[model samples]
Target: MSVRARGTLGRFLLTLLVALLALGMPLAPANADPTVGPAQDEPLPVTVNLTKITPTFADSSTPVHVEAELTNTGDETITELWIRLQRDQWISTRAQLQIVDDQQPPYAWAMSAPTSLSAPLDPGDSMSVTLTVSRDELVMYDAGAYPILLNVYGTVDGWENHVGQAAFTMPHADQRPDTPLGVSWVLPLIDQPRRVSGTDVFTDDTLATEISSGGRLENILDAAEEYGEQAKISLVVDPALIDALDAMSDGYQVRTDTGNIDGAGAEAAASFLTRLTDVADTSAIIATPYSDVDAVALVRAGMPEVLSDARTYGADIITDVLDTDPITNIAWPADGIMTDDTWQTLVADGVDTALLSGASYGQEDYLESPLGITESASTVLPNGRAIVADPGLSRLLTAAPQYAGGPVPAAQRITAELAMISLQMPTEARNVVLAPPRDWAPSEQLLDDLFTTTTNADWLTPMSLQQVSEGPPVDRGPLQYPATLSEQELPGNILESFAAPLQQVAELGSAFDPEDTDEALWPTRAALFDAASSAWRGGDGSAVSNGLDTANDALATLRAQIHIVTPSDGTYTLTSSDAPLVFTIENNLPWDVHYRIGIDESRSVGLTAEDVGVQTIPGGTRATVQLPTSVERSGAFTVVAQIRTPDGDPLGNDVQINVSSSAYGTAALWVTGIAFTALLALIARRWWRRHLFWAEERRKRADAQAHQLREDAGDHGQHEYRSDDAIVPPDFAGYDVPPRDEHR
Candidate 1:
C-alpha cells in the first residue's frame, strides 16, 4: 500500500514489457541486409465498377453490355492490362448456356469471339464490352443470374500480376422489355421480273451512296458485293445516280402489258402469270407499258386458281372462312429527284415511304417491295450536295404516280407503318415478351400461326431462312425468258456485303429521342427501355399488376366451362358448381403434343375429339392452359381433352369440363362409422394403462425377496464397505487398530 511499494511494482512491469518486446522483434547484428525483393507485394490497386452495365436493344443479336471499371491500387505501374471473364465453372452448367468469347464459347462445341483486349492503366483506369441474348435464352441459362468472375491478370513492372477480381453481372440481359415488337420477315416474292446478266455484270465498287447516315460507302459496297456473290442482281448504271433518288417525289408501279405480243413472248408471259395465279389465286394479268399482252391473254386462257379478268378473282372455295386483306406498301420519294428541304418536310406532311436507287431491293431487277431507311451515324444527306424529297411531295406522289391504278387501301398503309418501329429494350426478364407460334414453317401460312396477347408485346414475325430440303432451290420453271444484261464484271466482294448488314445492325448502338440525349435523360430513358416493357405501357408508367383483380374475374368465368379427363376412359368422376360440359387441351413436353377431346355423338359442329391443340412455349417456360372456347356450353355426357408438356408430364390444364351428376357418390353412413370407431379406441387405451401399473408392483416385491434369500443361504463373512473418500472417525475409546500399526 506504500508509495515505495507501488514504485517497485511499476518498475517490475516496465522491465517485463521490455523483455517481451525483445523476444518478438526482428533480431540481427547491429546492421544487417534489408529484406530482399520489391517493397510491395499487393497488385496495383484494382476497382471493378459493378454499376456501369450498358444495355443493348431487344432482338439485337448483341446482348446487354457487362461493363467494368478498373483502377490501379498498387504503386507499381500497370502496363498491358488483360481482363478475363470466366463463367463460374463451379456453379453454371456445361449444358444450359452459350458463352460467346474468345475465352468462353457460347455453346460448348462452337467457337467464341476473342474477349481479351489489351490496354494500359496508369494507377487508375477502365474499359467495356457487351454480351447479347434473347428472351428465351435469358430464361434457360441466363447470363444475368450466372456467377461471373472477371479476373484482371497482366504485366506490372516486368512481373506477372493479378489485379484480383470483382463480381459483376450483365444485369440487363433480361432487362429487355416484354413489349412485343412488330417483327415480320420481308420475303421477296418468288417471281416478279429478274434481270439475267449473262456475263455476271456488277455495279462499280466506287459508286457514291445515297443513304444519309452511318458508313454509306461501306454499306453500298457491302450490299453490292453480297448481290454479286449470289449472282442475283444487276447494275443498271455504273452506280445508278442515287444523289437525286432520295430527292425524287414518287415511285413507278409496273403493270401488265395491254397491247399485242409476239408468239414466244406471249407463251412465256402467260406461263409466268399462271404461276402467279397458282400462288395467289388471281383472275388475270393486266398489261404494262412494256407489255407483251398477247402472252398474258394466252396465260389467262386456262387455269383453276385464277379466273379471267372479266370474271371473279378466283374460286370461292374459301366460303367457310372470311378472307383477310392483303399487306400493302407505297413507294416514297416517288421520283429519282429531291432537295434537302424535301425529306425535312415529310413528317409534317403525313407521308410514310421513300425509294432509293443503288440500294438493296433484294435483286436490283426484281420488282421487290423495299423499305428505304436512312442509314449511318452522320447521315448527312440533307446537308451538303445531297437532296431529299419534301414530305408533302412524297405524300402527293404516293397517291398518284406511286400507286397509279394500283389497289392500295388506306388501312393497309397504316398497318405497314405500325409493323416496323423499334423502341428501347432492357435486359431484364420483365422486358422480354414471348409470342406463341401455332406452327413452324416458311410460307404465307406463317402469318396465321402468330399468337395474339393482351400483353405489351405487339407483333409477330417469321424467320427469313427457308429450310432447304437438303438441296438447292427447286427449278419450278415457267420456261420463260427474262431480261438480259451486258456482261461486265460487277465490282463488290460477297464477304463484305453479308457481314456488313450484321455490322450495320450492330452499329445502331443506342439512338435517343432528340430532346433527351444528355445525362439527365437516364431516368426516363431507363424507364422506357428497362424490363417493365409489358407492365408500363406508356410514359406515364402504369403497371399491369393493378389490373390483375379484373383478370381474376375473367379467370373465374373461364374456369367454369373447362373440360376435364385424364383420358375419356378414366373412371374418376369430377364435379364442380358451374360445369355444363367442357373440353381439354394437351401438350407433349420437349417434343410434340397429343390432344384428345371427347365429342357428343349428337352435336356435330366446331372442333371434335379428333382435333389436337398446339402448345407455344419459349424454352424454360411451361405450356399454359388455354381456353379454346366458352366452358358454359351444356351438352351430352362427355369426358375429353388432355395434352402433356414438353417434358412429357401430364397437365390437364388444357382439358375441357363436363357435368358430373352423382355417379356412384359417397354415402352418409360412411361418416357415422368413422365417428363411432374413434370412441371405441379411446376406451381401450385407458384399460391398458391400469393393467400395466399393477404389473410393476408385483415385479418389485419379487426382487426384494430374492435379495434376502441370498443373505440367509450363505455365511456372509464379515466385510467392510467404507467410503474411500471420507476419513474414518474414532469412538471415545480407541477404535479397533487404525493406520498406526497395531502389531508394531
Candidate 2:
C-alpha cells in the first residue's frame, strides 16, 4: 500500500504543480517575497525627479521640455497618477541672492495644471513623464532667471497629493535688444611660491609641473588656447610664478623637508613656457608684483619703500624671465581692496588702473541692476581709474557646470543678467569686467559652454583689457578705501619680521651700487619680494617666516666670509708695547667685497687705530689689513675688528680680538726677579749665623781636650807614687774634673 500510493501521490502532485505554474499561480508565500507590499499603516506616495530637457532658449517663441520620473513610494499602488509643473520667475537679482531668503525663494507664481500619468505606478515602481511647454507658457519672456518646480500627485488609499518634487530653471529670452553688454574677462595666473623656506631664488618645479601637466594652470592654458583671439581675455600673471618656472627651466635646486634636491624640471618648465608664450601673443598680459605683495598690508605697515621696490622688481623680473613685455600700467592687488596709500603708491609707480574688489564701491543705488551703471566696475580717480570687479559675474564665471540646476541653468542666470543690462540701455553699451577667483577650478565643458553662450548671445560683446582701459573715464564720486577687516588684517609684527630682511637687502644693494654690478643687485630685490609675498597667509606664515630666516642666514653667511682671522681662543698676544697688528680679512663672496676694517671705539680701551679705511678684497681670496694700534698701558685689551661699507654701513659680522700687551709681561718679570734676590739674601744670613755658632763650639771643645790631657798627666805622676791609694782617688777625681771645668 505504501509504494503504490506514494507513486500515485507523487505523480498527482507533480501534475498539479505544473498546472499551477502554467496558470501563473505563486508558488512561494506572499510574505517571503521582499518586494511584495508595504506596511498597512503606511500611506501612498509619489516622487518626482526632474530632468533638464531644454538647456537653452533663443526667445519666447522657443519650446521648453522638462522630463520627470514619477515613482509610487508607498505601501499600495497609486492609480490615476499625475505630474504637474510649476513655474516661478526669480525676482531677486544675482546681487540680492546673498541677502534674500534662499530656503523658500520668492517666486512670481505657483501651482500649474496637472498632466495625468499614462499608467498606474505600483509600490517600488516608477515611470517617466515628459512635460513640454512654450517659453510664453511659463511667462519667462522678459529676460530673467526662472526657477521651475515639478510636483507629482496621485490617488492612493483615498486621496494623496504630491509627496515629492524636483526643482530646476528655464531661462527665456536670455538676450537683449540692439545694445550689446560689454564683458571683459580677467584670468589670473598665480601660484604660491615654490620654495617657501629656502634661498632668494625659487628652487622648485611646482609651477612647472602645474603649468605643463593636468593641473590648474594647465586648465587655464587650455582655456586660453580654446578661446584664441576671439575672446577678449586678459591675463594677470604673478611674476613670482614665472620666475619660479624660469628657475626650474635650468636644472635648479629645491629645498624639501629632508634637505635639498637638484631638480630636473627644465623640460617641463620649458614646455609650459612655450605654451605660455603662445597664449601671450594674443591676450593682454599683465604682470603682478614679483611676489604678489599684499598691497593693503604693505600700506598699513607704512612700508612705502618696500612697495616701491616691489613694483620695479616685479616688472623687471617678469621682463627678464619671460623675455616679454607686460602691461605695467595696471596693478591688481590681492583681495581687490586697496587703501588710499596703496592707490597713491600705485600712481607713483605709473600704474594707471587698479583692479579692486567690488566692496570698494557703494552699490546701494544700483542693487537691482548693478551692471546698468557704467561705474559699477570702474571708478574714476584723480590720477587713474579703479576698476572694481563685478562679484556676480565673477561668481558666475567660477560656477561649475555641474551645479545644482545644471550647466545651462547656471549659464542662463548669468546670461539673463547680461541681457537685463543690455535691455536697460538700447543704445548705450557699458563695460563689465569679470574676474575669476584666484584659483578657479572649472570643468572644460562648463567653460566651453559659457564661451559659446557669451559669443552667440548677441546681446553681449567681448572687450579686451586694452580697450577697456583705453576708454574715456567716467566722472565718479569720492573713493571709498575701507580698512581691511580684523580677520583679514595682517599683523604688524609679521610684516616687520619680513621687512627687516628687505632693509638688509636695500643696505647691501646700496653698498654695492658704486661697483656697477647690476647682476648682483638683481637677486637681492627678488629675494626681498619673496619674503614679502602675499601667499604667506594664516597660521604664523611659516613659509614666509622661513624665507625671512633664510635671507638673514644668507646675509649672515656672506658676512661671516669676510670675517677677521684670529687665534683659536679669539685672543692675540703682542710682544711689543705698541705696534702694528695685522688682521687677516677673508672675502668668500663670489664678488669683491669693499669694506672698511675699523676698531670698535667702545671696546678699544688700550688700543688706538690708524689707517683703518675702506679696502677692497678680491673674491675667493684672503687679504691682510695691517691696522696700526697704539697701546696706552700694558694690560689685556680687546681689539674690535668691524667690517663696514665704503659709506659706513655695516656689511658683515663683527669680530673681537683679545690682545695681551707686552708691558704686562715685562712688569711681571721684574717682580719675579726681585722676589728671588730677597729669598737668596735671607738664606745666606741664616747660613752665616749657624756656621759661626758651630765654629765657636768647635774651638771651645779643642781647648777642653788640651786641659783634660794636662790633668791626666799630673794624675799619672801621682798614681806612680801610690797605686794602692786608687780607692781614695774618687773624691780627688771629682775635684780634678771641677778644676778642669773651671780652667775651661
Candidate 3:
C-alpha cells in the first residue's frame, strides 16, 4: 500500500475505537451530587425524620440531643439499621445557609457513635432512634449556624449502602451578640367564611370542629395563650371570623342538605371568644379586611367599594366583638402581592402601610447576599411604608411543617438562619418579619418550638409587627410582582362571578325604604365580601359560587314578598269607557317598600292605561292604587299589571286582568239618537191618522143622517123610515162604523 493510504487507514481505526468507547461509557445524571449518597435511581431502603432536637441554639456547656423516626419505605424489609449524627463547618453567610443542601459540607467536625435498631424494620413500619452529641464530641465550634445531617446505614437485601439522610442546621452562640436580630412573627387568625349569606345559618359544621380541642384553630389559640406573652407575636385577625364566632356563641343555626339544624358549637365558640379576648389584651391585634377580602381582585372586579367597606367594617367588628382597639391601617394583600392600581386604591382607602413579600420588590440579587444580611425589612414606598417579609423565613415557616420532620427541622433551620444573619452583621441591628400564609395551619408542636426557639436564642429578640413596621427603612427598587405570584392571586373570572349577586343586592336595597337600606343590604354585602375572600384563590370557586347562590336566593325571597294581589273574580268591570283601574298591592316585608304600579296594555287594542305614581306600602299592609284608564270602544280585553321599582326594575310577577266595559261609545250614541227620532215621527203619524179616521167617521155619519132625513121627507108616507133615520144618528153612537171602501 502507498504511504498516504496507510496513514488514512490508521486514523480511521483510531476514530472507530474512540467512538466505540464513548458509546459504552455511562452518562452522568443531570445535576447529580455523588457525595450525598447512592445513585438517584436507587430506592432508599430507609427514611429518617428528625422529630425533636433539644437545645436548638447550643453553647459550649450544653450538649445537643436529637430524636428521629426511621421508617422502612422500600418494598423489602431492612435489617441492621444504624443511625448517627454528622456536623459540618459553621455556616458563614445567609446564602450559604439557603443553599446548604447543594453544598458539599464535609460534615467531619463531629460524628456521634452509631446506634443500631434491635429488630428488623418491615415495610411501612417506623422505629424511633435517638443520638446525642456531647459538647466535647462536637469540638470547639464557631458562633454560627452549622449544617448537620442524620445519616442512616442499613443492610437491604444483604447490601450495605447509605439508605437515607435528613439535613438541618444547628445554631451555636459562644457569646451573645451586642445587638440581636429583631424577629417579628405575624401569626394569622383567619379561615374560610362559614356562614351562609343573608341568614343566621352556617354552610357547614366544620367550624365547630375547628374551634374544638386538638383543632387547627384550637392549636393556634393554645399557642397564643401559652407563648403570646413570652414572644413578640402579633395576632392578625379576620373580623369576619370574629363576627361569625360571636353569632355562633349566640346559638346560631347550620344549614344542611336536608334543612337547617341547630349548631353544636355555641359553647365552644363562646369559650374561644373569651380566650381570644384575653389573648388580645397581651398581643397586638391587627385587623384584616372583613373576611380577608382580596383587595386586588376586588378592585379588578369593579368592586372597590367592597374593599373599602370591608376595611371599615372589619375594624368595627374587632372593636365590638373583642372589645379591643385594633390596628387597621396595615393592609395585607392575601397573597402579599399587588399592582400599582391596587396600591393606590388601598392608599385612598386610608391605608398607610402594607405587609408585602420581599419578592414583591424583585430584589433577588440582594436577597441572595453572601453575608446572611440583606436590606431592612421595612421599605419606604412612593406614598406608604411596606413591611416586607423575609422570603426564606416565610417559606420555611409555611412549608416546613408539612415535611417529614414536621416543624422541628423547620424550627431549627429558622433559628440557624436568624443566628447566621446576626453573626454576619453583629452590629447592624437589623429587623426581620416572619409572615406566613394567611391560611397557614400550624401544628401545636410547631408553635411551641418556634416560640421556644426564638425566645431561648441569645442572638434573637422577638418583636411585635407594629414595632417591625416602625423599624428603619431601606430602598428596595421598584415593585416587580412576579408572574408566579400573580398566578396565585384570586382569578379575575372568580371575582367577576360576584358582580351579578352584588347588583342584585343593590337592587334589593333600593326596593326597601331609604331608612331600611343599610339594614336590608348589609347582610348580603357582607356575604359578597366573604365570596371575594383570598382563601378562595387556587380553588375551584365552588364555595364562592354557593355563597353567591345563597345571596341571590335571599334577594329573591325578599323581592317575592311584595306583589300585586289578584282580584277575587280575576276580572274587572268598567262602568264607563274612561274610568280608574283599581289594583291592590300587598307588601309582606317587615319594612316599607316603594313601588310604581305599571300597567301593560300591549295585548289590548284601543285601550290606554295611565301610570300610577310611586306608592309606599307599609310593612305587612295592603295599599290600593287607582290608575286612570281610557278605552276607544266598549269590549272585553286583557291587560297585565305589575309593580316595579322607581328605577324601573320589575318586582314580583305580572298579573293578568279581564276587563269588560258596559258604557256606549260616541258612534253607538249617534246611531241610537237617529233611530229614536225616526220612531217618534212614526208614532205621531199614526195618531193623526186615527184622528182623521174619527173625523171622517163623524162626517160620514152626519152625511148619512142627512141623507136618511131627506129620504124620510121624500117618503113622508113611510113615517117609520123617517123615525128610524132620525134615530140613526143616535144609534150611531152604539153602532159599529161601516167599511168605507166605496168609490165616493
Candidate 4:
C-alpha cells in the first residue's frame, strides 16, 4: 500500500476514536444550575466555626473531638443538614505546607456517620454541634500536618449542595523524627515611650491599664512566669519601658490635656517590677536599645552617636533595675529587616550577632538539597553572624491571632509545620528561631498552647538564642532587604525633625560648669531618644513630634530660667563713655550655670560692647556681670543682651536695653578752651599790673632820685662835679639804675 493511503486511514481511525470518547462523556442537563454551589459574591447558606479542637496533636488511640457552631447566614435553609469531618493526605514539606489549602488531597477518613441537625436552621439561626471521631472508626499512619475540612451538607432553596465549610490543620503524631529540630523562642516585651520629657510625669495613663491584671503586659509577664522554667524562652525588654515603670513605682504623675494628675499605676508598676526582677533572676534577658530606637532611621538621619548612647544607657538601666547583665551584643531590628548601611552601622557599634528573618537573604541562592537540607537558620557575614529566623514560623507566632480561623488553628498548624520540617531531614539536625513582633501581646490560652506544643512535640528540642547563634552558618549570598520593609521604617523627615531638639538639649547640657553635674538634662536626652523609636513607624508621627516638642520646651524652660534681668524702666544710664554696663543674671535653676553674655551692638552706632567671658551664677542665686562698653559719642542707643552658652548658642529671650549716656563728650573740650583763654587773660593782666607796679616803683625811685639828685646837684653844684656820675646818668633812663650808680 502507498504511504499516503496508509496515513489517511490512520488519521480516519484516530478521528473516529476521538468522536467515540466525546460521545461517551457525560453532559450537564439543560436545566442544571451553574450557581448551585458557593459563589464568590453570594453568601453561604450556612457557616461553620470551629470553637475548640481537643488534643491539638492526635495519635492512633487518641479520639479527636471538635466543638463547632453552625450558623444559617443565607435567606433559605431547608432540612436534612448533616456535618462530617474530612481529612486529606499528610503534608510532607514546608513548601507544601504553605499551600495546603490549594492542594486537594484525597479524602483519607471521616466520622462513622454524619451528625444530622435536630431542627431545620432558619435565617440568622445558630446551632452548637459536636463531633467525635473515635479511634475505632478513624486511623492514621503518617506523622505530619493533615488538612482537615469540616463540611456541611444540606438542602437549600430546594437544592442539595455543600452549604458551608471550614478548613484547618490536624497534626497526627504517630512517629518521631530521628533528630529533633532545635527551636528557640525570642519573645519581646516592648512598648512605646510613655514618660514626658524632662519631668516625672507620664504622657498618658494607658500604661496603667497595660500593666494591670489581664492587661497586655500582665499577660506577657504571666506567660513568662508560667513557661519560663518549662521552655527556653528569652525575653527582650526595652530599657525605656523599665525606666518609666520604675518612675511609676515611685509615685509619678500623668499629664493630661488639662493638667497633671497622680498616676494610678504605682502599685501595679511596683508589682510588675518585682515580678520582672524575679523572672530575670532565672531567665535569659536581652536588652533593646533605649526605647527600641529606630537604628536605621537614626543612622540615615546622621545621628549615629545616638545608637551608642541608647545602648549604653539602656544597658545601665537594665543592670540597675533587673540586677542582671543582659545580652547586649545582639541586635534585633524591628520586623527583622534592615538595609546594608544599617547592618554596617550595627556591626560598627559592636553588635556581633543579629536576629534577622530568613527572607532577608536571597532564597534562590539556598535551595533545598537532595538530602532535604533547606535554608539554615544562621548565616555568617564579614564582621558578624545573623541568626535567621524562619519567616514562616515567625509570622505564625506573631500574626496568628489575626487569622480568620483564629489562633487555635494557627497553633495546630505551627506544630504541624515543625513536625514536617523535622521529618524533611530526620537524620540531620537543623535549627530554627521563632521571633514575634516587638510589641506582641498574646492571650494566656494562646501562650499556653504554644508553650505546651513546643514541650510535648517529640520532634522539637527547645534551645536558647545564644545556643542557636553558635550553630554553623549558611551562606545565602548578600542580604536582600525588601523595599516594603524599608517603606515601613520610621521616615527620614521625622528623624530630621529630631535634630533641632536633640542639639538644643545637648548644648544645654554642655552649658553646665565642669564641676557641676548635668543630671538634670538626662530626661530631656532620653525623651529625644524616645522620639526616634521604631514604634512611630506607619504612624503620622504626631506622638513623636509631641515628644520632641516637650523636650524642646524643657530646654527652653531651663534656658528661660537663666536670663539677663531687664533693668528698671528698661533703661541704663552710663556716666562715662568707658563705664562698664552692669547686668544682673538670674539663675533660677538648682545648679550652677555657666554662660557668656552676648551683646548685639549692630544697632548701636558708636558703641562697642565686650563679651563677658564665661561667667558662672551659683544655684538659686543671681550674679552681676560688668560688660566693658565703649561709646564714641554720647547719645541714646539700643543694644540687645542675650544669655548664651560657651558654644555661643542663644539660650533665652534677648533683652533690649535703651542706653542713655550723660558723658560730657564735646562740651568738655569747649569748656576747657574757654577756661584756658580766661586763665591766659588773667595771667596777662597780672603780669601787666606787676610790670606797671614795677614801672611805677622805678619811676618813683627815678623821680625821688632825680629830686634827690636835683637837690644834691643843687647842693653839690656848689661843691664838686663828678665825671663818673655824669656818664652813668644816661643809663638810668626808664630803669631803677639808681642803686648801681650809687654803688659805682
Report each candidate's C-alpha RMSD, comma-separated, in the order given.
Answer: 42.3, 18.2, 11.8, 10.0
lDDT of the candidates, in the order given:
0.27, 0.64, 0.76, 0.74
lDDT ranking from best candidate downward? 3, 4, 2, 1
Q: How should the candidates be ordered by TM-score, best one leading?
A: 3, 4, 2, 1
Looking at candidate 2, the ten consecutive residues that score lowest on lDDT are: 27-36
Q: Is candidate 3 or 4 superior in TM-score?
A: 3
After superposition, which runs of candidate 1 have C-alpha atoms over 4 Å from their true positions?
Answer: 1-152, 160-178, 184-329, 332-352, 355-744
- lDDT string for model 3 (719-744, tens) is 23344434432233443455777513
Q: Residue 423 of candidate 1: its Cα lDDT? A: 19
- Which scores greater on TM-score, model 1 or model 4? 4
lDDT of 2: 0.64
Off by over 4 Å in 3: 1-49, 69-81, 101-110, 117-128, 154-165, 200-204, 246-266, 364-372, 491-508, 513-515, 539-554, 573-584, 601-613, 620-635, 660-744
Residue 672, model 3: lDDT of 75
TM-score of each: 0.17, 0.68, 0.77, 0.76
Number of the top TM-score candidate = 3
lDDT of 2 by residue, 262-327 (tens): 776678877777788878788778988878877777777888777777777667777776677888
lDDT of 4 by residue, 1-744 (tens): 875566456545644553464354322222222211223465457766667787776777778788788888888855788877766445667777665533444343333347887788898999988888763344344566667666677887786666776666776766667888888888888989888755678879988988998777888888788887667888999999999998889898987788999999999999999999999976788888998988877887888888778888888899999888988989988777777888888888789888887657744222344555565577887698888888767766665655434456657767776776777777887877878788777766677778888876777788888888788888767888777667867767767877787777667766786555346677677877788888987777786787677767777777788889999899898888678889999988888888889677675554677766888888899889898977656778788887888888887788988888877444555677899999999999999999999988987886676556556556435333354433124223344335766856
